[model samples]
Structures are given as C-alpha cells and as structure tokens.
Target: MATPPKPTKRRTYDAAFRAEALRLASESRSTQAAARALNINVKLLYKWQKAVQTPVAAALGASLDPTTAAELRQLRATNRRQAQELEILKKAIAIFSKTDEQ
Candidate 1:
C-alpha cells in the first residue's frame, strides 16, 4: 500500500504585509512581475489589488455618510495595527519573563 501525501498548511498574512504587497504590485510594471519579485502567486496579487480598490464601507455594505465611513475605515485599520502590536509585546514579555526566571 502507498503512503498518503501530506497536506500543506495555508499561510496567513497580516494587514501590513498585504498593504505593502499591494503597493509593490501597483508600482511594478506588471502584477506578474511583482508577484515573482515577492515570491507570491500572481492570482493572489491580482486579488489583493482588487480588494484595495474596493472601499471598506462598500465591502461591508455600510450606509454611513462619506466622512463617517472614511473615518470608520481609518479607525479600523488603526485598531488592527494596534492589536497586532499588542500581541507582539505580549510575546516579547513572555520571552523576557522566561529568561529572567532561568
């Protein structure tokens, strides 16, 4: 009997990385070229470009005024960034605490 092949784990990217990748794709000559440079799939690059072009309010189907919607989007982005930073700090603290106890 033949052994089964192992399944590959799906990779997760944070908001910052996706934003930077989208920026690079926009500045590059072609999405394919950008994907090659970033070592990501061309289709994923195209999807990211499409996503960036879509407004968060519209994507969420929100019915707020333009200014409020824009503000909400900015606040959401800031919250995500802060939450990620907090996670990093928590992990760093854990590492330092472990070392201090050794």
Candidate 2:
C-alpha cells in the first residue's frame, strides 16, 4: 500500500513581518499577488487580512471622516480615565480595609 504524503510544517513569522504582510494584504493587489510580493503563503495572507480587516471592512475602501476619528479618540480617552479611577478606588479601599484590621 502507498503511504500518504506528510504535511509540511507551517512557518511562523515575527510580529513586524506579520504586520507588514497584513499591510501588503490590505493593498489593492490580489491575495496571490500580495503573497508573491511579500514572500508569504496566499492562504496565510488571506487569514491575516480577514483578522485585521474585520472592524474596518465596512470602511475598507473609504477614508476615515474627522467626526469618526474624534469620536474614537474621545471614547479611548474616557476608557483610560475610567480605568485609572477604578484603580485608585481599589487602592483606597485596600488601604482603609488594612487600617481597620490593625
């Protein structure tokens, strides 16, 4: 009986290279063309493209409007402030609880 061929191991790419590959994949070229240019697998490039493009898919071909950018920046700022406030509250509670135990 003939034995089946073994599958080849997948190559792992560094973060910087992966990011570049994704960038290339995001360009107007076809997946195969991008893969050829980037020296990566077409399937791998497609997967990375899908992962990175999920949120931006709707806006893929369009530029980001100023209002949208401003809203995103505000939301990120608010999130950071809330996180800082929560950390301070947690520290304050810990200090008070320790004082009460003494």
Instruction: Point to the candidate with the largest lDDT.
Output: 1
> Weakest 10 consecutive residues, lDDT, candidate 2?
53-62
Cα RMSD for predicted model 1: 8.7
State every prediction's TM-score relative to the real structure: 0.52, 0.44
lDDT of 1 by residue, 34-78 (tens): 999989898988788777655664476546765875676578789
**Per-residue lDDT of 79 in model 1:** 95
- Candidate 2 regions off by >4 Å? 1-7, 55-102
lDDT of 2 by residue, 1-102 (tens): 999999999788888898777656545357788899877778888777666543654464347665765476468669989999999999999999999999
> What alpha-carbon RMSD in Å does predicted model 2 have with respect to the real structure?
6.2
Taking every candidate in turn, the Cα RMSD to the unseen true structure, in Å, is: 8.7, 6.2
